[model samples]
Target: MTALNWKLVVDTRDAQTLADFWAAALEYEVEDATPLIDHLLKAGDLPEAAVAEHNGHRVFRGYAAVRHPEDPYDPFTGIGKGRRLLFQDVPEPKTVKNRLHIDIHAEPDGLETLVSRLESLGATRVNEVDKGPAGHWWVMRDPEGNEFCVA
Candidate 1:
C-alpha cells in the first residue's frame, strides 16, 4: 500500500483576505510566490490577467496560501504543515455548511484575545457550541463564511 500527502484547498471569493486571516490566526506566513508568477509570465505560460497583487503578495488572480510558521514544509515546492489551508478564487459564495473544518486550540488566557483578534480581522462568531465534554467552542467563520472552531 502507498500513502500520499494531503491538504485543504478552499474556493473563495476573496483569496488574499482569507489567506491573511488564516495566517494571523495560525501565526503562519503568507508565502510569497511572486517568483513563480514572474517565471510563468516570462515563459508566456500564464496571462497577465491571471496574476495580481493581493495583501502585498503576488497572487493568482484566483488563489493564495497561508501556513503555520513552525509547520514543516516541503523543500521542493514550499508547501507546509502537516495541515495547510489554501484559498482559491471562486465565482460563487459559500452556500452550505462545511462538511469538514479546522480545529484551533488557544493558549491559556489566549482564547478571548484570539477571538477578538480574529473578529477584528473579519471572522465572526456563528454560534457557541457546547458539545459533550468539550464544554464550549466558538463556531466562527472567515470573512467569506468558511467555518472553523476557536476554543
Candidate 2:
C-alpha cells in the first residue's frame, strides 16, 4: 500500500469557528462527527472526558475537518471526499508563519475578483508577491491568520 493518506490538522483557539470559516474559504463543509461521537458516548463506547468545548462552542476538542464540495465522503468515516483541512482546538494562538502553506493558482489579472470574494467571506490578502518563474501570488490569511498563497 502507498503511504498517501495525508491530512494536516492545525491547532487553533476556536475549532468550530475555524471549521466554519475554512468550510466557506475552501468551499468545504464541517464534518458532522458529533452524532457519531455522541452516540458512542451515550452507549458508553467512548469516555465523556474525550469531549470538551472551546470558546463556548461544542467542538470535538480534538479535530474537525472541511472538504471541497462535489467530493465523495468515506461511508465508514463520514469524512470529506476531496481535499480536506482539519482544525483542532488549542489553548494558544499561532505564533509563527506556517512551515507548509498552501498555494492556490488562479488568473493573476482577476486576483481582485478572488480577493473581493474571499474578503467578503472574511479572508484577507496580506502581501503581493512579484511575478517570476513561479508567477505572481498573493499571500492571504484565513480568519485565524493561517497563511496561504494565491496565484
Candidate 3:
C-alpha cells in the first residue's frame, strides 16, 4: 500500500490564535500562505470575505496552520510538506473530552519546566499523575480547552 501524507486538523474558534499557541508550544513555524492568497485575490479566484489579515499578512479567514521548521514546503503556497497542524474556525465550542489527544514527551528531569512553559503559553494544568512503575505526567488543556499531555 502507498503511504498517505497527512496533517492534523484542529477545530478552533479563532484559527490564528490557536495556530499561534500551538506554534509556540511545539516550536513550530506558522504556514504563511500569503503568496497564494494574494495571487488568488488578484486573479478574482478568491473572495475578500474568505480572507483575513494576520501578523500583517494575508491568510485564509477561517484557517491557519503550523509546521515543523525543518519541514519542506511549497514556496508559492507556503504549504507544509511534512509534520503540520492545520487549525480551522468552527462556530460551536468544544463540549466533550477529546478522544484523540497529543502526548508531548519532555526531556529527562525537564517535565516541570516544560509544564510551566506551556502554562505561560495559555495551557491549564488539569492534574498531575504518577503511577508507581508506569510513568508520571501532567494532564493539560490548551487555551481552547483541547486536552493534551506533558510527560
Candidate 4:
C-alpha cells in the first residue's frame, strides 16, 4: 500500500480572515494563488466574481489556505503538497464543539508564552486542564469557534 496525502479543510464564514489567523498562529505561509488566477482571467476561464483581493493579491473568493513554509507547492496554483489547511466560506455559523481538532505542542517551557501569542492572534481560552504527571493543556477556540488544544 502507498501512503496518502491530505490537508485539513475547515469551514468558515470568512475564509481569508480565518486563513490569516491560522497562518499567524502556525507560522505558516498563505498560499498565493495569484498566478493561477491571473492566467485563468487572461484566458477568460475564471469569473471575476470567483476572485478576491487578499494581502494585495488575487485569490479564489470563497477559499483560502495556509501551508508550512518548508512544504513543496505548485507554483502555478500555489497549492501545498504537504501539511496544509484549507478554509472554505460557508453560510452557517459554528454551533457546537468540534468533532476533530488540532493539538499544538509548544516548545519546552513555552506554553504560557505560546498561549498568550495565540490569544493575541484571536484565539480565545476556553479552559485549562491539568492531569498530574499525565499532562497539562489549554483548550482554545479559534476566532471561528473551532476548538484546539495547546500544550
Query: How many Å off is the CA of 88 in candidate 3?
Result: 0.5
Residue ranges of candidate 3 with Cα displaced over 4 Å: none
Q: Which ten residues in a row have the lowest lDDT in candidate 1?
A: 74-83
> Which lDDT tens digits does candidate 2 get at residues 1-151?
7656566788787777777877776667677666677677779987777776644434465677887677788754567756788887787879999998877656648767776777887888899888688577789998889898877
Please give, for residues 1-151, the per-residue lDDT of candidate 3 as tens digits: 9888999999999999999999999999999999999999999999999998999999999999999999899999999999999999999999999998999999999999999999999999998999967999999999999999999
User: What TM-score goes with each of the models?
Assistant: 0.85, 0.79, 0.97, 0.98
lDDT, each prediction = 0.81, 0.75, 0.96, 0.96
On a 0 to 1 TM-score scale, where does candidate 3 land against the true structure?
0.97
Off by over 4 Å in 1: 1-3, 72-78, 131-133
TM-score of predicted structure 1:
0.85
Alpha carbon lDDT at 122, candidate 2: 80
Best by TM-score: 4
- What is the Cα-based lDDT of residue 127 in candidate 3? 84
lDDT of 3 at 109: 93
**Candidate 3: 10-residue stretch with minimal lDDT:** 127-136
lDDT assessment of candidate 1: 0.81
